[model samples]
Target: MRIHLVDGTYELFRYHFSPGNRDREHGATLGVVHSMLQLVQDGATHLGVATDRVIESFRNDLWPGYKTADGVPPELMAQFPMVEEALAAAGFCVWPMVDHEADDALGAAARKAALDPSVEQVLICTPDKDLAQCVTGDGRIVQYDRRRQKLIDHHGVVTKFGVTPESIPDYLALVGDTTDGFPGLAGWGARSTATVLSHYHRLENIPDAVGQWEISVRGSSKLAATLAANRELALLFRRIATIDYTAPTFEHLDEMAWTGPTPKFPELMAKLGGAHLVERTENLRRHRDDDRPQ
Candidate 1:
């Protein structure tokens, strides 16, 4: 059996800028709920969606420039609560992260689901780079970009980033993550970062001096000096980039089960203005029950 874990924050962001939803009231939220329902239609019985109900996570305190809800349209911000409520009402296990970011929940879920013997594969439904570290060696866990229909396995991680999954944080630390708002040291760019991290596999593991460096790189003298000077800062940035698996998402895997929508689903559908979604959900619920093992 396969379990599908979604990043609700990414979906909501994708829906909001999708060119069509701006006109419809609560359209992005409607599209999000509808998109999950389509997953059910496509044969995902065990599924979970993690949302960032409040955009300001503890990361904001760690770094002042960390992402916040400051500039997000009130319309988009307003839909977060409703999205959690509606997804819950629709019978999907929803983890609305507040203190931690949404990816933390996803990492926790991926780890827990992989421990289950019945779970043949776990598909993390997001394209975020930080989450790539969650990919496993056995290929039981992978990242899926639903928009592009792309699957990123462990090998794909190496191919795309020129480093192993374990090196993603180091890569980000050197190259800097613009989205997360930590500026990497000056002179570090994608190619140099990937080349060094690919060999060292971690910031700490890299030799501090250019003379001791094993790999050939362009402008190694300047890059090596910058890294040595900001070694402490680079480590802090890596810590920032790494996902916290121990963060509270849920107690057990069963908490993520998707039996069917709750009784309040009809009301939620009404509020979200997606009546057609309610009908499809009801039909799928009945059919799902019928197919369940007695």
Candidate 2:
């Protein structure tokens, strides 16, 4: 069976900014939970959603400017705890990340789920560049961009980024991710960064001399000099983008499968002003019962 892992943090942000969700109360979190449940209803058996319980992760200590909750609105931040509680009450496996962020949890879960023999595929439900590193060659792990409705495999990564999935962290390091607050080396843009990193596969392996480059790329000399000058910073940035695959472990695929809502779902839904969800779930349960052979 295909195991689906979701980046709840990204989903919340997407829904918050989405046109259809702007005026709804707690719409982002409710929409995210609804969307995830729809996935299960549509045949996703094993599912997991990772959320950022605390915006600041250990990575913040590694880099002072890493993304944090400081700039997030009070309304948006307030929904995080509610989202986690709602997800848990719904009987979905929610990883409310504390020490690590949602991205790291998703990556770690993907790696762990990919190891299970019963899992036919592991679809990471996010377009986050950092999560791209988790894509594997065996087709076990892949990324699904819900907004674009694109399923990005290893080959797709190469097609989109001009480099293999393995080179993504390195590529992002050179191009920089403003969302994450890591400034890449100067003079590195998408094309130049892809051209060089595609060949070298990593920052450390790139030849120091421009003339030594095996593949001919534009502005090779300038790229080399920039790399030489900011080698340490570039590596540090890459480290920030790279996902840690060893955070939490899940040995069994069954651990992730949907088991229906928790006992406290009724009360929790009431608190979140999600009475509609509770009613729908009860109706769904009744329908299932009515369908069962007597």
Candidate 3:
């Protein structure tokens, strides 16, 4: 069937920042638990959630400007650990990343799950542009933005970023991700980077001189000069943008299939003031039990 891979870190950040979400200490955690239960109720069988236990990953060591837990609201940061445990109690496979970021785990899980012949589709549930690189042209793997209810396929990647999924890292490298805290080449902006990358595809593929470039770009001469002067720096940014697929994932697809909540789920929900979720989860589980072929 289909595999639903969620970016738990994004969900936590989204709900935590929403209006009235911070009033309760566990508001974000409770919000995420409700979302997961809703997913199961909506017919998701195989599902996985990846969360960043620590915001600072190995990328921080590679570049000093890389994203860290710094500046995140104290209430939001406090929910990171709680979200993972709550999702686990709700019977969802949670990949709590330590050394690697949650994006790496989502990429790894998407790639691995796509390999299973039995999997009809692998849906990575996140609007993060970085994860757009994981979408495949064949549509076997795609991204579902649960918040907006939007689906991004290979074509969507090209439409949004003006480059193919394969060139996303290169595009991000040249244009830079302010969210990830890296500045790209001085003159490079989204349109220029996308236009250049749409042709060259990768940093190394671009020629050193403007005259050497087969395609024309505005300020091609200056862009060429900037790229030539900072070749190694651009490459480093690309390396950081590329997802580390070696990040942890399940050994078997069956491990991702939801069975039911654990015994601790009720207690956990009670503590989080989400006891209503307990009834909803039980109803969903009971419905699944009745639907299963005996």
Ranking by TM-score: 3, 1, 2
Model 2 regions more than 4 Å off: 22-25, 249-251, 283-294
| Per-residue accuracy of model 3 over 1-294 as CA lDDT, tens digit each | 999999999999888888968555899999898898889988999999999999999999999999988899888888899999999998999999999999999999999999989999999999999999999999999999987899999999999999999999999899899999999889999999999998889999999999999997999999999999999999999999999999998999999989899999999988888898988888888999999999
How much lDDT does candidate 3 score?
Answer: 0.93
Ranking by lDDT: 3, 1, 2
Query: Pick by TM-score: which candidate is best?
Result: 3
lDDT of 1 by residue, 95-185 (tens): 8998988999899888888988999999999999999999998998999999899999999999999999988888888888888889988
Q: Which stretches of candidate 1 lie over 4 Å from their true place?
A: 22-25
lDDT over C-alpha atoms for residue 108 of model 3:
98
**Pairs clashing within candidate 3:** none
TM-score: model 3 vs. ground truth: 0.98
lDDT of each: 0.88, 0.84, 0.93
The Cα error of candidate 3 at residue 67, in Å, is 0.8
Evaluate model 2: give its lDDT: 0.84
